[model samples]
Each structure stands twice: as structure tokens, then as C-alpha cells.
Target: MTEAHAGFAPTGACWICGGERLRPVTRAIFEFSAYAQQDPELARYTGATVEIVRCRGCGFAQPAALPSLPDYFERMYDQRWSDEWMEAEFRDGTKDLIFREVVARLSDRVPARRRTLLDLGAHVGRLIQLAAEAGWRAEGVELNPRTSAYAARATGLPVHRADLRDLEAQGRRYAAVTLIDVLEHIPRPVEALLGVKRVLEPGGWIAVKVPHGPHQLMKERIRGRVVPGYRPTVADNLVHVSHFTAGSLRMALERAGYVDVSITTAAPVLPPPGQGAARAGRVAVRRGMTAAARVLPFGVRTPLAMNLQAYARAFV
Candidate 1:
């Protein structure tokens, strides 16, 4: 529901790969969403006029006019202590659902008694709260002061308002670092990953989930707005700069020094192609999808997949 503005003309090289051949893919908008923090006013944003661009080389997707730092944080931040947004968690709680399952899956590596975990993008601290229920002493770093304060008050846990990279410099460290759906937001994911490594113990584990590159691009490729009889392509809200596939994710993580990295794909609860949404409920949507994928052959899986990736790169 964003304002209608014309997309920018493409004349420059791609942002990441620097390929001279970059192209405009879509003219769309993403509204202020409370998936991260709790802010009713954020809904006021309605949406932003965005010119979506694609890199022919790496297939990275980003808005041509991404909000400046001030606009991205200060303006759109949800600082109103809005309970409406917090209670609306069940509506779009993909971030929490993925984090919980990831932790349970890696429970073998992380002891039940482990009580120290850090979330880099802990807006409103929902992931940290969930981790605490499982005995993890969770802390987080969120840039939005409003959400950070609310998170601290609500969860009684520390949600520092600072850049993730600065945590290590401030004499803070952690055992495990969870970056759920964060890599996609950062302008420089590699740098953020490096910073995450600095605060992690030697041989610590990092669990990351990124949108499957090909899967997301496939939605972009669909090339139609009003299909006679089909659900809209899950609203391509590609605010992310880097869309990481299994291969690209592995490469970037390896360069960031994560050693034992493995990638597994999760079919979204709403199975691709209007298969009537995987299982209909919040919990079942994703968990059920993963369970179904485990039993079925690869031939009958959703092309749009979520990556439940866990890797232990070098601790140095």
C-alpha cells in the first residue's frame, strides 16, 4: 500500500558484483511491517516507492532508492510501545518459527543447560525470549532505540542499541550467534558476519536463514500481476540486498571462517503454487513443510524454499 512513484532509470553498474549489465526487474513497494519491532506508527509508512534491481552476475536484489540510514532507522522504527504490533506476532512470525526449530535441531550441539546466546538482529527480542524458554541466557543488539527499550522492559533481557560489529569492541562476547533473516538486510553481510565471528568463542556455531536465491527470483520471473486463478507471489518484499543460495551462502560463510557449514531447504508453510498453504496454522506452516519435505522425494517439493542452515566455521 505504498505511494505510487515511478522507478529509477538504470544507468550504473550493479552494487555488489560490479557487472556493467544490471537491469530493472520490478516496480513495487514494501510497507512498514512489524515482523521485527513493535510499532503501530510503522503501519503509517504504508509502503515505499521502490525500484527493484537485479544483478545479472549474482542475482542480488535491492531497491534502487533504499531508505537512507536515518530514514531506515529513525523514521520507520516502531518506538511507540505498540502492543498491537507485538500481539500481532502470530500473523507473520516466520522469524520466531525458524529460530525455534533451528535451535531445537541443533540442540545436540547446544546443551540443554546452555544459557548464553546472542541475536544480532534482535528487534523487540522475540527470538531472545523464545531462546530463554529453552534455557538460553539470550541477549541482543538492535539499532532501533524504541524497540530496544521495549524489548528490555518486556523480556527483562538486554537488547543493546548498537551496531552488531561494535559488540565485540565493547568487551561483549557470546557462545552462539544467531542471525535470523538478518543477512538479507545488511548492506555488507560479509562484514557483519566477520563482526559476529569476533564476538563468538573459538569454534562457536552460527545459525543463519536466508531466502533461497533461485526460489525468490522464480517469483520475480513469474511475470504477471493478475493471474486468472492464482495467489499472488507472496508479495515480493525483497528489501534485502543479497539473496543467498546454498552455494553463495556457503561461499560467503566460508570466507567469513565458518567451518562445518551445512544447508537444508525448508518449504514455506504456504507451499508454492497455491497448494493451500502447508497445514494452515502458524506452527504447522513451516514445521509441517519441513517434515513433509523430509518424507517426499525432491520431485514434489516447493520451489520457493527457506534455508535452515547451520555451520561452524573457523573460530579464529
Candidate 2:
């Protein structure tokens, strides 16, 4: 094992509630080479095993132990893609449905005069571009150097490669902020939300989207039982350090001082173009699931709730 793997430390408290009563859920080995097939830089830690634990206080799940490396997340996400791949990602329309929903919701809530928006963890600035077209003065905050540069060049807009606290220090404020598929990867989610809140204008709205962690895990387990040679990969190598349910996600936002929080089912990414019957069938299933989830109460626990979409206002 690498020193980083050998030096793992227990997560002593719940990230959301600071609860010490945690129960072991499962363990999974990290086949780093398999996961790194596309990003060869992550192949250094090949044999690390991670344990997931659920907090009894809030029912939030997270890694029982965390890697000792200080720069673990940075190293894990340091992908080097070719310019051609980046261009393709920039033009992909799979997530356009999600981007449109978020923008529409924000436009309804935020006033026209205060239409500045910030997209946190902007991958290729696709959403920012769409928001710009929708008449919002949109910008982004990306930590990855390559993606930040590419997004800025492609969109002709500012993409700051700085931490949220740095923007807060600079008095940068926006009427709306978004963290799409970004919160799951962060640890101490409550603290992260608080930092995001600091950069928002008073009464500004924040939108977040994350996978329904427990439901996703259940699906993976069922698939493993029915499919041949299938391995569950939800919390492998602690890539997703925090796993959230509907209740836990709301609790995190509330504890971080957000008010008027609302959560619903988020739209799924569409399949690539021109796959014929298979793509059509997948789209039908996904749309049906999303529609089913919308009718049910947000507090109701259901498998149809594949992903959670949350909007809350910072009402300080």
C-alpha cells in the first residue's frame, strides 16, 4: 500500500451534524488502475480499500476513513485531456435539459435588475454560456487550470481559478449561484455550503444538484445481484466522500443558514446522439422516473428519486 493509503484516518464526526455515532455500511477495494484507465495519473494508489459509514444522528453516509494525502482531491481530479476532447465536451448537449431547468428557476426567483450569476465548479462553461444567452451576466469559478482557461477562451467570459473564500474576500457577490453535480465530491458539505453562501448577494438564491446517494447505492446492489461480473462503484476509493439522502441534504443547507429551501428530482443527462432504439428506450425510462419523482413529496423516500435538485435562498 502507498503511504497515503496506509495512513488513513477515521472520520470522527458526521460532516453535517457533528454526530459521533456512526455505523459501518460497507467496504470496497480501489482498483486504481481500472478507474484510471482514462486518466492514467490516478494509477499510483492501486490497492487501497475504503469503508463507508452511516451517521446514526442524521443518517448521512461518508467514508469511514479518509486518505492521509493533503492534496488527494486535487491529484484525483488533475486530468489531462486533449484539446479535441475538451472541445467535444464543451459542445455536448446531454446536460442541456438540466442547465435549462436551473436557469428558468433562477430567472423566476431573481429580479431582472439583479441578474448576476456564478456557476461554481464550471466544467467547460456550457451552463454559463447558456445563462449568458438568457440575458444574465454569468461568470464561473473553476479550480482546474486547464478547464478554467478553456472555458474562459471559449465563452469570452471571466472564469476565476480561485477558492470561494477568495471571492468573498474580494467582495464578489452574485444574485444566483449553482453547484451542479459538484456538492457530492466535497467533504464537510455544510462548511462548503457556508463558504458558498458568503459569496452570494443578500437574498440571493443557490441551486445544487447531486445524486441521491442511498438510492444509487441500492440500485447498484440490485444490479450486482442480477448482472454478471458487476461491481458496485458508489464510494470507491472515497471519490465521493459524502453521500446524502433527501433529509440529510436539506439538513446540510438549513444548518448552513439557508432559508426557504426546496428540493425536487433533477433531470438526467441524455444519451449521446444517433444510438437508435437503445437511446430512445433509455430516454423514456429516465423521463418516466423524473416525472414520477416530481409527483411525490420531497420527504417521501422512493427509488424514482434518482437525483436531488435543491434551491435555497440566503436570507441574511
Candidate 3:
């Protein structure tokens, strides 16, 4: 299939595998933000077309092209985004559970006597805080100055306002690296992993959490056809450039030279903004999901959940 184009530029090749063999997945021309639908001034972006494509070579999915994102992101975290998201995440102990899972996975595979963790895209520094509490020396790399500053002030953890690429210049190595919900937002995920490889100690581990592909959006895709509220668009998630299935995520990790790579699925956590009656219903659903997640085997959840956690170790 011909590569899809967005506005003026061509998407070139798959960001994960550098393949030109692409398959068209879906197309939409809708506003990314729910609020944009109500405001005429902001609604101009509703007309912009976006095409989601899957790479036949690597099974990776991404948009046809990524537009200039810095401006959008700067405004997003500063204005629309909040540290409350992480606070809420911890309220139910999900983030803490994830931290323990990552630590245990690395402890089993990496024979390092001491563990030092670097959380890439560590917005608000909750992971670092959790790691430090668990006896791991932790620091963070964040791109947003505001969030980085907040993370340092709130958690007293050292969070550098820079990208993972900047760590190569510091010459510091870590025993573990984390990318929670971070990989998909990056335009060059493979290149970022290469940088991660450079900054890790031998036998060090990396843990990543990302949304499960195609399936997470299946309902939205079906709904957009019949309901205006569910129209598929990239506006709200303008920062996310890629989507990963279990196969694609594992492939990316192996391609970057990781060993003993393990991927597992977790219970689906519904996004926020629940109404009065619906909010109560969502809470009940979440409670049930939390219970099921505790007992469900990894084999059963891997194909059914909406999120996946991956752990990989670097080798000599």
C-alpha cells in the first residue's frame, strides 16, 4: 500500500523498524479535544485529517505523519494536564503495584547488587519517589520544565529537565530505566531505546508501560461511525505518535538488544471524566477490574487487557 500523507510531508518509514511496507488502518478528520468541539475558534483543527497506519514488517502502528508537537505539548502539560492524574493513579495503589512488579522483575534477572533507577518521561516524579521509598536510588529525566520542577519540589527527587538523549552526555549509567506510558508519545522510539542502551549498566533492565494497540481503540472506531461524541481523532492525544501490540513491543525491545524480555498485560483502567451516575458505575467497574486483575493469570490477561508492561535486560 502507498504510504499515507498528512498535509504536506510524507511519513517516510516505520519509526520502530524503518520499513516502508505500511497498511492503512483507519482515517479520521475530527478534533482531538472534547472541548474543541464546542468552541468555533478551536474547531478549525477538527478538519485536519489523520491516518493511522500499521507497519507490515514490524506490526507497529502509528500516524502517517507527526506534525510540530512541541507547542501543543508545552500548552498541554502547563494548562490542560495535571499531576493529579498520578495522584489519582496512586490512590488505588496501581502505580505502587507497578513499581513493585518492575523492581521484582529486575531483581530476578539483573544480578546487580545495587539498583539505581532512571525514569524517562518521569512527569511529576512519582516513580522515582516510589523507587526511593523501596531502597533504590532514583532520579528522573523529564522534558517539561514545569513538571520537572514540580517533581523535584514535591518529591525531593532529582529530576533533570532533559530528554533521555541528553543523558548520554552526562556519562552516567543506571541499573534500571523506566518508560511508563512514554514510548508511544515519542516520534523516534527505536532511537530513544538506542540511547537507553547506551546509558545502562551491563545486565541492567528497562521496564516500559504502554497502551495495548488496536484493541483499545476498537470501541472508539466502532462508535465514531455512529456517534459524534466518539469520533476518532488525534487532537486530544496529539502527543502520542505510535501504538504497540504485544508482538510489536517485544520486537522493538529485542531489536534494541535486550535479553530475557518479558511482556504482561494488566487490567484495563478506564480514562477519567465520569459523570454523576456514570461515575458511580465506573467506580464499581474499576473495583471489579482491580479484583480480577489480582487473580487473573498473566496468560489470560495478556490478550484481553488494554495495557501492557514490559521488562527487558541489557546483556554484554
lDDT of 2 by residue, 31-131 (tens): 56754565444565567787888989887999987777667788778777688878888886788889999999999999888899999999889999999
- The per-model lDDT (C-alpha) reads 0.62, 0.86, 0.70
Cα RMSD (angstroms) for every candidate in the order listed: 6.3, 2.5, 5.7
Range of the 10 consecutive residues with the lowest summed lDDT in candidate 2? 1-10
Question: Which 10-residue window of candidate 1 scores lowest in summed lDDT?
Answer: 266-275
Reference-based lDDT, residue 36, model 3: 48
Return the candidate ranking by TM-score, descending. Answer: 2, 3, 1
Q: How well is each residue in 1-316 modelled by candidate 3, as lDDT tens digits?
A: 3222233245778877889998878764545465443433333444466677889987788878654433443443443356676456434444555566666676666555677989988777777887887778899987777677777876788888865557767887899998888887776677777779877988888998887767567646667899967666532445566778777888888888888888777444443543677866976775465456546775424434567788888877
Model 1, span 1-316: residue lDDT tens: 4433333343255444456655676555556565325544444444555566666776655556544333444554335656667545423454555667766755657666654788887777777888888878889887767667767877898888877557778877776888877787665566677778777877777888777655665654563444555433422343565666565576667767678887666434332232344435544656665666556565122553555354554455
Of models 1 and 2, which has the larger lDDT? 2
TM-score of each: 0.70, 0.93, 0.77
Quote the positional error of residue 268 for candidate 2 in Å. Answer: 1.4
lDDT of 3 at 107: 65
Report the C-alpha displacement of residue 226, candidate 2, in angstroms.
Answer: 2.5
